[model samples]
Target: MKIKLIAAAAIAALGFATSAQAHKAWLQPSQTVFSDKGAWLTVDAAVSNDLFYFNHVPLPLERLRITAPDGSAVQAQNASTGKLRSVFDVELAQEGTYKIAMVNEGMFASYKLGGEAKRWRGKAEDFKAGIPAGATEVSASESLGRVETFATVGSPTTGVFKASGKGIELVPVTHPNDLFAGEKATFQLLVDGKPAAGLKIEVVPGATRYRDQQNEIHLTSGADGKFEVNWPQAGMYWLETASEDAKTTLPDAKQRRLSYVAVFEVLSQ
Candidate 1:
């Protein structure tokens, strides 16, 4: 399957979060591809009165719907998470065009007062399979602290990353042409020169402050030995990966660690 990951500039610009009335909400990968035999749709909502006072809000399943080209509407199933943000999974069978739409009520008011609702539309195709050779590994980690002030927000105290096993190559998704708003990107984690399994991956977008608190997005690996999320907004962001086992140890103490984390710009198309 040809998995095209699109990282487009956010249609809406990022600015300071001033009051509860200015919080914004939107879907990532505003565009997308359906190539997996079965596909999963992951939605993240960021609510901020101003950019600095951002909160990852949990959206209810009833708030959104996925409608296929065939006119079949699928409801999203709630996924597990430890944070305030809510994740929903929708299974796609035969593919064509799909539209993700939000219900115009309830939480819609919160999003509207803060911002507005947006949609991600695209095609879903069959995903191809094959293993690549000589894969490299990349890893990264960063410490998150509460926001103290607007202008002098402190840097992460400690950060580190490591690659799991052997075969997986960790490539930086940096170039503007590499990702867009409505597509999905795939990277392999190899084990002894083969696709690795049970790896832990973390994606952190730049931090913004709201109500004197700091907010970030965190993703764990799925059953496919891969971690995927939609990038709807543009700004500076980081992708970090490490062996699931290594997570048990402190960042300063770890063996067999190979990680990658780099800063990338998500520009508007």
Candidate 2:
């Protein structure tokens, strides 16, 4: 129910920094489940207070990654970053699903120096050199975040859903592009390529500024990391899940925080 705001200075490391505080970072595709091939898709990226709105700062595109249905890398075109949002266009030339994401990895740490508490955030590669030698009571947590959305030109494909074995990711039992209203969809949450059992998932419908309440559907992954969501009605839904554990990829850090978010549009059945 609480939405966290981000300062404009956090734009460079949107993913890692936002995980430390909190922000509704998302990639909103203009359309999903397209009926034809070779279609062009427009996507808007932002960290907003309301779902899918551009009232907040733009999500930087430096981390943007586009994957074609064949698992090949695709570049974003006509990309622009504005005050409140970043927009880009992707050409669906391969005739299957496409994954558009801002994948980020960084380090977040807090420690005591000179009897004063200080914090630092930077790229994972900079963790060792960035920490002061005399810093005491040091605590560091690596962060991996993926803000993504999917689009299908003709038929949906699974290539785009493959997990990177780092952060929390959604493995679809029901294809993201195939979701529908009044029906249940299954998905599995994974962290470091393993099952993320009991992790909490929040799914909220878009256009919430006009609504009285969020109407969020809360779910917990099962023992096998699987969970189900029954769509309340046909609309774009923002799905988010986060976890923190001692699964740090960096030995210097004690823990790692992982977050994954995706936008899915459900059609009327």
TM-score versus the correct structure, for each prediction: 0.31, 0.90
Backbone clash pairs in model 1 (N, Cα, C under 3 Å; residues 3+ apart or in different chains), count: 50
Superposed model 1: Cα runs more than 4 Å off: 1-21, 29-31, 49-56, 80-83, 106-269
- Residue 34 accuracy (lDDT) in model 2: 77
In Å, residue 227's CA in model 1 sits off its true spot by: 34
Candidate that scores best on lDDT: 2
Error in Å for residue 248 of model 2: 1.3
User: Relative to the unseen true structure, what is the C-alpha lDDT of residue 251 in candidate 1, on a scale of 0 to 100?
Assistant: 39
Alpha carbon lDDT of each predicted model = 0.34, 0.81
TM-score of 1: 0.31
Query: Among all windows of ten consecutive residues in candidate 2, which has the lowest summed lDDT?
Result: 1-10
lDDT per residue as tens, model 1, 1-269: 00000011110112112132233333333124434536565544343333322264432334454655455666666654334444555555544434444322100000111233332111111101111122222122111101000000011111111232332334223222245554555554444344556655545455444235323445555454555556767654444443322331233222222332323335455
Instruction: Return the top candidate by TM-score.
Output: 2
